[model samples]
Target: MKKIISIYILLSFSFAYPVTLNELIDLAEKNSPVLKEKALDIKIKEVKKKQIHKKKFGEIHLFGSFNRFEDPRILYPITPPIDPRNLVGAKNQFITGISYSVPIFTGFEIEKNTEISILAKRVKEIEYLLTKNQLIYNIKSIYLKILSLQKQKKALISYKQSLIELYKNIQESVKVGKKPEVDLLKVDYQIESVEAEIEKVKNSIYALKSALKTIIGKKDINLSVIEDVRLTELDNFNRTQLLKNINSLDTLKQATLSEEISEKKVKIAQGKYLPKIYFTASAQRNMGNSEYKDLWQVGFIVEYTFFDFGRRKHEYIQSKLELKKAKLQKKTLRLKIIQKIDEALSEIKTAISKIKASEKQLLFAKEVEKIEKAKYEEGVSDLYDYLLAKSQRFLAESSYYQAIYEKESAISYLQYILEEFKNE
Candidate 1:
């Protein structure tokens, strides 16, 4: 038995460390698959930007070919059998060359393309931050819920103990012929009901703990021993100030960037109608039996689609339409975000009011329970009144606890909307 007790002590020590809310959020940020994917997307955009930058560097290619002809054709017709060999081409010939071309001008298309890539990369970064903030909010919400349930469990335990004591007292009174057997039975029934409720709460706690573990990506770790979380109060929140700061939100910034990118695309589409200038250079060698020649050339090339049946014009118009659409979408999103913030603020106010009312109700219920207990002991009240008082007190306490956590959850949601979690 001593050895078994020692082993149990060791196990307890191994699992005793309490995980905090911040630590859980850190774990979630480190392990979140969505954030990792967003990071990869940023890298992809960076690579695409590099590719666009490289477009101005032009391309170099080497070429080589060998050919054999059954009969070489003569470039000029000669009198019959008169120096036909002088006009005939070589039967076997080889040609090898290296060529390079660089774009000197692309009508601003490359510049616009690079800008678009830059905006795309910025968008991905904003998306990553958005995902992280959302994760933090989810973790905080779950943490608050678990804390509330734990508090409720404590209240239930205390109530259950009180019920047990009342049952024992009633049983003793019945034995002494002071209280009837039915009173003892009623108290016994209440005790059983409280026990059942305790069991139900324990099950709920287990399920919530499991959910917490999954969120933190630590399925093997026990979250049942996690430390209690403290709620943060946004005491100095001003709607005007927060609304002004809305532009700092990553979501809004992403939307704005997208609009700018669309405008740049319109410029790119317009550039398609302009001419392109390029510089090209090449060196070549040709060889055949008893003959060899070398040549080099460099030149400028200008290309223009001058007449593409109005294709470029149509594309430019399409891009312009897309830009307008992006602007409208951004404006709509801004309005929605403002509305959401207002809603969250209203919820916070409501929760604060609830907390106050529930606290007062809990105080009154406790006093009533005390008075009912005293009356029952003095034979001035029956089992039904005492049980009803106990139920009301428990309900009041539960409501108070729920209101506190609800306020916390509302604040968390408000912070989430304002991107305050990103600072953490």
Candidate 2:
């Protein structure tokens, strides 16, 4: 009954759903606080764009006013019975009106302002994409590290098992007086070392999982059964094609859009020096008796700021300076992206070479281990030689797996730079 219960528990663990890289990224998209904040920023920019567009339609307002005055006396001595208030205006009065105004021309101010709003919205969109890509990169980094630790743990566990079996063989040899008891003690020490390494790796795995949970905003998720990291082949990468795709990067796009926005700001500042034309119309009714009971009027007005003590001039200069700065920044960003691509390509190449070398070394070490094991079993070799060979094989295996994961991580970084996460 106990054996059956243990088997059931093992099966249950095996059946637990494993978290995939895509799933983690999806969760981050939905739950990450940083992404959420960026989303709100995009919304704010969108609203601002709508406001700028709506301003082109003009405005209408309804207004009313009332006034009361005290009794008045005659102004002239000959008109002693005449009241000055009656000659001048009503003592109590009320007025109401509806007024409308629309801009007939704005020295391209409205057009430039709208362009600024549109560009601002695009900038926010790029910012959101940048944040999203960064989050994906972070998650991929953590996931790859976890896989590396897991691989190391597996290697250590395998090494520990081998040491155990070797220890058993050494103990038998000691009983036959063929090997010294100290050899058994050495094997015991090696086993303990491997076990210690295993423990350390397990702790690292726990810490990494906690970090991943924090990123995805899930505090209690179990991330033990993550998918294995797949290797990216060098033959599949094309540097020329990748460089062409660099324009799709969020960072580059953002810099370009920012430069455009700065240019629009310069135009907006220049608009202040030109004339503004507007069409105005109004209808009003006097509640109290007056010379005109109701009136309506319409007119057009053109106004220009002939001078503002160099205020507008200074603003225009400042805007041009900002535009220059933005252009420089955009140029710098392009160079940085090119550098990043080159670096990632180099890393991928280096990791691939290391992986190949480690694989060859592992194969050679495995052969050496086999020979050492046979020699030790036949009393032709010391425990030290056999243990050394086994350790070399273990290290080679670990190094190979580490290289594989490193290559995967480098590819993930390259994808991030290329904005492949956006497609995902």
Candidate 3:
């Protein structure tokens, strides 16, 4: 454990590229196009929720029309002996009225609407969080790759230095008739091969950084050196507890409210068949082009739709189907969430085992290289054997970093599963 901590400190001092997880998550949220669009949707839904919050409000309607003498208000006579009461005027009719109408009863549109509004909000929120989780995964994955590359690079450089010293000793021995020239050539070839590999890995690291910059929305972000980082060394996290807190993803219960609302919409459609009670109290000033006079009228309307093709039936069936669809979708999401959790847990177990194995391999390689160095100088080992041991150590070191990266990536998967990435 101390060795691990020391490795982190050494890397931090050598290369101070410090970007915390929180900063990465913030950058992603601030710059993501998808999250921004989801935010807009949330705002629009919120506005709708606020506007329709009042279940019952009076309806104020006003209308005016401009007409020529060709079509006058009195052009057509009223109904039943052309009574004035039956005539709806069309000449500059400026009729304004406030009709006070309470739900008196809606097929329950108010209740359904309230539930749907809340569910809509949840859906948008989940979309935003899902965006956040994806961003976190992308950023952290890239970040881990960068660190892994740096660790491998450092190990290669260290191994190269060790081989340089050992080769010089071997050369001195060969000149003194203690070692073979062939062994010297072998060391040179080993050095060249390892150097090529290091270059290839460096290119890979560069590509990973480029991908990360694009995700962060940087036009031209330069990647500097990244220090080795050991993530929080905490006790084993509770997957159960984490998933329990992630129940927000299960907004299906709330989504089902839409079905309830649809049920209410069906009632509302049926209500269209029942008589509606509306109180209409209005004061209007009537005027004509010739000697205009003011006339005031007030009344209440008890209106009912007497006959229509099966329009109400169509509306009820459409609403019922919509409700059924929402319920089915909610159920599907529940199963999806469980599958996601199971996959993450499997990855986590694999990563943990890999990390443990990497730790032992790294330790063994270090000891092997140290022994080979001492032996080569004492003429107990040939130059070729010495260089091979050095290269092997570097390989082991790189593998250690690969294991570290895999561990972090697995943890990221778990975080996504549990929705802790939103906190990031």
- Per lDDT, the best of the predicted structures is 1
Q: Pick by TM-score: which candidate is best?
A: 1
Instruction: Write the residue-wise lDDT of candidate 1 on 253-301 in tens digits.
Output: 8999999999999889978878999999999887766566677889999
Candidate 3 regions with alpha-carbon error over 4 angstroms: 1-17, 26-35, 54-62, 70-106, 163-189, 217-289, 296-315, 366-387
Show pairs that collide, candidate 2.
Answer: none
Name the weakest run of 10 consecutive residues (lDDT summed) in model 2: 71-80
> Each model's C-alpha lDDT?
0.86, 0.85, 0.68
CA RMSD for every model?
Answer: 3.8, 4.5, 7.4
Shift in Å, residue 312, candidate 1: 2.7
RMSD of 2: 4.5
Tens-digit lDDT track for model 3 on 1-424?
A: 9999999989866776666655655776788666788789889888878766775565655544334544546523234665666454445433332323344444445555766677677667766766777778878878887887888877887776766776787788889998788877887777787788779878988888888877877645435654455674542766677567655653444455555656666666655666766555544444334323344445556666676688877887887787788778777877777777777777777777877887898798889877987887687876566667777777777887787777777777777666666666
Q: Candidate 3 — which pairs collide?
A: none
- In candidate 3 the C-alpha lDDT for residue 289 amounts to 45
Off by over 4 Å in 2: 1-9, 64-96, 175-177, 234-236, 248-250, 283-297, 378-382
Q: What is the lDDT of residue 382 in candidate 1?
A: 84
- Better model by TM-score: candidate 1 vs candidate 2: 1
If both were scored by lDDT, which would come out higher, candidate 1 or candidate 3? 1
